[model samples]
Target: MQATNTLPLDMVYHWEATKADSLYLTQPVGNDQVVEYTWGRAVDEARRMASYLKSLNLPEKSRIGLISKNCAHWIMTDWTIWMAGHISVPLYPTLNAETVNYILNHAECDVLFVGKLDDWEMMKPGVPDSVRCISFPLSPPNDFETWDDIIARCSPLEENVQREPEELATIVYTSGSTGKPKGVMLTFLNMAYAAEGGMEVLKVGSDERMLSYLPLAHVFERTFVELASLYAGFHLFFAESLDTFVEDMQRAQPTLFLSVPRLWVKFQQGVLQKLPQKKLDTLLKIPVVNKLIKKKILKGLGLDKVKLAGSGSAPLAGDVLDWYRNLGLELLEGYGMSENFAYSHINKPGRSRTGYVGENMPGVETKISPEGEILIKSPATMLGYYKDEEKTKETFTEDGFLKTGDVGEIDEAGRLRITGRMKEIFKTSKGKYIAPAPIENQLMANQSIEQVCVSGANQTQPFALVQLAEGVRDKVADEAYRKELETTFSQLVDRVNKTVDPHEQLAFIVVMSDEWTIENNFLTPTLKLKRNVVEDTYEGKINDWYAQRKKVIWQ
Candidate 1:
């Protein structure tokens, strides 16, 4: 019940003995098939793998690379690495060969565990030939040794290995929205503090079910979902693919749910596709029908059972947060980063306010620097960036608070409202600095706008490049639809411009013909816009876009 000082491996061992027969993970294979792992079975497999890893005779605390989409084996492999007295390094599955190569080499990984991924072919070349490779059950065809084969030959490690609290547990790389990713070194204690504190605060019970589709490589999902489940002993489910997401959600019937801002908006748009926003708003006014309609809508999205829903990884629009709340779902927005094990601040159940990521956590301290950057000190704070002491030194203050790099203000109630990224703010030719996030959030209120990147470094005024929503983009070819969209966006820009300072107001909105995606290098693996990449890709067209001078320019 109390916040735990126990490490993650200890929690796994605890569950293995007490909840041995309980269903722990449900991993969906392709074609509606699922493979379930009980606490006993999962631990046994991890032990056998641990024995295999020991046989390899790697150095103590050697870095072991893990590249996988969220899967049962990914969790088990992490356990195996810890049990064998090594450090786990998880790479985002969406990484290109170059980035993958850089991380593995930079970390000096001795082994690489390849698991369920959509882009194995592209990432395979990144694996160093010197490091041994092991493939999970769901991994694509490869010449590497298989997990089942190793488990078949090896015996479960009988010794109950306990890791030191301060021992390095994992290295989670950043999503690289700005530049090359940095390896964040987290200890066992760091992981425990975040997971146990979150579990206790959220009141997660052993009976709770959760779906894990977000990249476990990201600290947000790793600490909150994966590690928290270890402490809470909740049933975790892995999503198979994007196409089967709704079905997978329905199958899990998760009591706890976590999502990012973009997906939350997409879910809203999906609901609007069936029931127009105007009609849904009218229906909600009718009390009796409203309850039924809300329930039905949530059920269709496979989130009717979700009780403790959370939104994080980016700022969710206040309206979108309200939309989910109107359906009687208690949605909370959290704030954290890779440097702190993603355990900074979280909106408490009843104390939540839209547009603000709630008060500092129980053992967390927050203060704004003179320059407007939010600084945090938490029990879960990372040791430092791996092999980058200089950068690590630059990221923290003399008093030990980690510089969050996010500009925000603490309100009277102690809730944190993120204003903008310090690095992301840009100046117009007139020397007026513009914070784009608020304006972008305002622009996103329009259902047609999928993604927006506001930029104008030396230009007279800032402009926005937007990717139209999926359904909206499909209709762009139609002349009537195109005309309607132009008018809608024109009105959107005007409405958004009024909310900002005159200098900060957008000069125009350009609807891009292409979608920004991880594959295209426009978005980070965590789905945040890679501003530099997006800007550089369209640098030459900026002049053309401005020369057009139209309120809504189509590209």
Candidate 2:
């Protein structure tokens, strides 16, 4: 596989030189409204933005913040920042004012770019007076300069701005589930290495279509939609909103799809709602009916055209993977972190294990440390944490391997199965240690469960606090619904307990009626459960749950 040597700006020039008239981005603003950009147009617009950014006369390598949902302007701004010799700082659109303030101050962003957002009033207080504000389409409330106005006012930059591989590209803040977010400094070389390695494994072509809905603030989406698209020259499509996700997917008919485990589980539940699990199972056992059923299922979900589907950011349940595989979509699981540009381990097309995140990618090395932590050495490894030299030094080993903080064992075939996070494993009062991730994975297999956290800080045994699925919560007070839930949860707990050690058996399963959402601070922007938050919220209620006689308790 050939490695990428040129910087992203050069890649843009390459695409423009080769495929000038080809469609590059499609952004939907309304039901029937879409703005399309060819590779040539996108380059011209980015150059115009770059010209304007240069006219500001900001210091070289100045940190520029971008706050927006996924859109063409977001990518264009990123390219513009890089081309103008500045570092990009992307903030999550759903972030609160305090966090936004923290990130902006921490990164010392000189210029802030605002795009399509939900609440500008809530975020306005965070924007410091020192930083210059620039607005993209669907302008935010303020005295910021608009994107169209800037492009119209400035001429296209004619002089090519050259960048080295080791030059700083972006500062991506980790979406920390437990503590304050830290900035991960990534270079052009790091991103390019990741894109080259991933493209080698996936072999995506220019014709490949991808839906860009995930937060580009995260490395996962940024790597695929922004970085890899530049390398692979694939067409990118943006989702209008959550309400039109299905319609967007159908219109894009993406050849490659990547999503988190939570969405994959929701897809499973969506299918089960139409075809009950029992009936679907029975039908799958039949000869020709199974084929037709699989087609209908995938077509309904707009995934029938997907050649490669992947789940990451969180561990996916084996049952959910099997469910999709049965429908003829190999839902491969990959593993990586922000520090590595998410270019570590990925399951290959025809060679994937059920419960493991597959082997290391090209030019990557992985091993389990003596302390059972997964360590990685790769070209894509980040330079360091942005502002904290202490934390950065602490994250890597003396021998240069990045300590992943995940406890895992490598199989004989080199596949890695994550056991638990080192900080997340809790010990019972009886001196028994429990790994919650495996249990949580098993519990999530139950159709009624949406999210769960297992903890027993000083108790004799661990118990689970579960958030019921959305559909189940709709009929909460109905006697029939409650009875059905209790029965199913009881069975699930019993089955899980039987599979684990006696000391690790759950004492009770407490189901919560409320939903866990990013807006509520229960989940990260990437849809990963905030276990620390969940445990803290339900810690006081656990004793009462355990005191109840029933094995399943509803809160």
Candidate 3:
């Protein structure tokens, strides 16, 4: 459980010595093509990239921008930036031109590495002419140097390059859910401490396998996928695209799987499509039949081999956790933020609390403020917000605890149940305050609901704006499906309302056909809903929604 007090590049060197011939990265190319990189080859390629970057003759500690989906080249680019003594600035692939431009200019990025974009045309306008651009494998059309060409032309770095543990490593930007994304400056020590603390609790091995599909720009994926892999020597697999996700998972048979709650709900819905919930529940009651059912279900979802599965980046409903546990898959819930490198708390395996994120991680300290905000002090805490001293000072306590902004309380056992965001609690016209997260979590138990936002500021009672799960639209035209949905949702709302305070009961459920996506700005890169944006977009229609006599109104 001792921390690896070495830099990321130093850990890479350790892996090169211990696991030279082992596979480090697996990237899928075409339908039948895949590219594999051994530890030695990966290091060599990274060294070549470092050489090329060094050739640019940029100032020491210059910022380098990386924009791409999760892929092998993305990790390679990060290693190259670190080895070349530069700071990495990652951009979400789904970012708009304006946001991308803002991050690059604000960071004063001297060079950019572009890789595998969904829409290059949309992002092209944001690239400043002053900054040089380089392209990675499978890059889009652009007047920039290619990754392959650089590797072929540049000589590999001959000697080892090291960084101090306290030196600046990367600048991670927040998801911009509340406002403009602010740059968070994280040092090598911060990232190393987080990786070490997480691994100490998780106890992963070199043989552990993982799939990389989440946005690497987010601290969650970067910590688990990139930093953890370096610290633990785990083999990382990259999904080809959305189309091949299941196949990729099946191929990797990952031992550790991590995902957001949205995808977990989708997986449950997919199983429900094949076998109705009632039938599955009945079969699960029988001992022998239950084992077979769980096996088949897990295999179908490509999670049969996953010994550790987790849900994070948002609150997971108790029902969802129970559903997975019923099928013999223990879904651990975790809580953290970008400011802390996601090294706060995680439910330990075989001892998970159903409704709470587990104990504070090793070497991390946590306490609740008088205002009920969760404050954490850890070695993994970011140094400060880049070039924003005022905002940085506002985010931390005078005593040095990082203010998490989440309102939560710790139980007697030290488990944490996140109630809601401090700023998200809405006051109704009836002078009652409502916490929307718990209500939203309860509503999400209904299979028909994909996402929900509860709002009623200045209203008598709060109501829910709901988005239906995928494929629900195609089935809506069928009379039976429509009736079944209406019946289920009606019963669900009634059941949930009876469990909550009367003032907190939802007035009506506004079912909307529109989808919330990262591309559309409704969801952040981490799949968290932008509540302020959702409320702003639907504020004008709340009056009509409230006037409807029916409990469920479709928009």
Candidate 4:
């Protein structure tokens, strides 16, 4: 293991110079080859940006925000924000205008950094005039000051801008399922402790390689990208674009892979793309082809070289875990919230519980309250919600453990298995409580269904709002074919309903024409369905789906 040198920002260059010199990000620069940056250059850029930030003279702990997608600028901007004395706030780039304005006002931020995004111009109307905006990569509307312009106007590096371990560093706003967004305040010590703990757990070292594809605005990516990669020297490769993600994954062939459950399912779907179910099943009947198929899939996902592959943000299915295990991938599920720096319980390498979210992470203590809420306390937990003392005070018990909102059980082996969100579970007319998650997880295992939201409020039986697999629309565009598919879907609902108890049966199944996405606000950034949106859209229609009671028919 290489020793880490303390700097204002995390550095791959100083600790692992050779690997850092390797091409890290591989994205396009217009029509030319991909614009690549070396770790040495990245560290220097962060320092220069930090120096520029010091020139601004913002008050200590003042809120600063960046609106952008997952890009090289995102990291540089984050480094600069932290390197400065001011606190950092990152917003969802895809947020609606109303939500964006609310967050901007809620944070009371006066200075905002803007970056390249899809339809950025459309959102300009909602930005508060009080906030001064600087464009990143400082592209056009030539009136605004560019990032480089700021750097050029700053004093030279002093070599004395230090970040104390306990200072408030970053504030991340979470789009919670039950309510509007709230800023979660975290200190340098909180992040560093999580990074430090993760390093030991993963046995990460200089030789380890990682691919950064998830949104860095989220806590999981911030810890993994900033802290872990710094302390343990790992080379990073960024995806070129949305169109080039799979090819880029092939090119990077990373050893340490981390993804949310949605991407994990997508990767599995990609594997199945080439090998259709009927054909793959027929080939598995033959001995040699089955072994070869497994090898092919394991290699395709870059998992052939993977030391660890994790599913987090949401629970993955046991059957899905079994399927991945067949291909020689170590699929471990982890559980944590944005409130705790996303590292409370992890399915560590070698010792894994496919059903459980794994044992508590090192130095973190987890206990289930009598009401089945998961309670955790550690240095890694956030200091509190930013400026919301009432909510923060309510987040903890009298003994000072943070309430996780998740309903879970700890087994004899001390592994945590989350059953459902306490609020999401609903009671049926028969008085039997239905846990939506397990049913939804099982429904998702079917490749045809993309997103499923289960609900049973004031209904005899629970139901699902299903988003279809990608390209399912174009494939079924024909009116006749669409009708046929609707018929087949009803059959599918009947099959699924037969497998469960009477009260738990899916009485309603609606196929969404448009996909549920983070941008659409139907899904949170983490890709979990916003149950409220799904329920709101179908609340009146759910009864309609059941009133017809006609199988083998279109709506």
TM-score, one value per model: 0.98, 0.98, 0.98, 0.91
- Clash number for each model: 0, 0, 0, 0
- Candidate 3: list runs displaced more than 4 Å: 1-4
Better of 3 and 4 by TM-score: 3
lDDT of 2 by residue, 417-512 (tens): 999998888999999888899999999998878888888988988998888777777877899989987888899989999999999999988888
User: In order, what lDDT does every prediction score?
Assistant: 0.91, 0.90, 0.90, 0.75
**Cα lDDT tens digits for candidate 4, 49-162:** 777667667777678888876666677677677766677888876777777788888888867888756657666767899887888772336356787777666654546356
Q: Give the per-residue lDDT of model 1 (tens digit) for 345-413.
A: 999999999899998877899999999999999878999999999999999999999999899999999
TM-score, predicted candidate 4 vs. hidden true structure: 0.91
Clashing residue pairs, backbone N/CA/C < 3 A, model 4: none
Instruction: Supply the TM-score for candidate 3.
Output: 0.98
After superposition on all CA atoms, how large is the RMSD of candidate 3? 1.3
All candidates: CA RMSD (Å): 1.2, 1.2, 1.3, 3.2
- Which stretches of candidate 2 lie above 4 Å from their native place? 1-4
Q: 199-256 in candidate 3: lDDT tens per residue? A: 8899988899999999999999999889989899989999888888889998789999
Candidate 2: what lDDT? 0.90
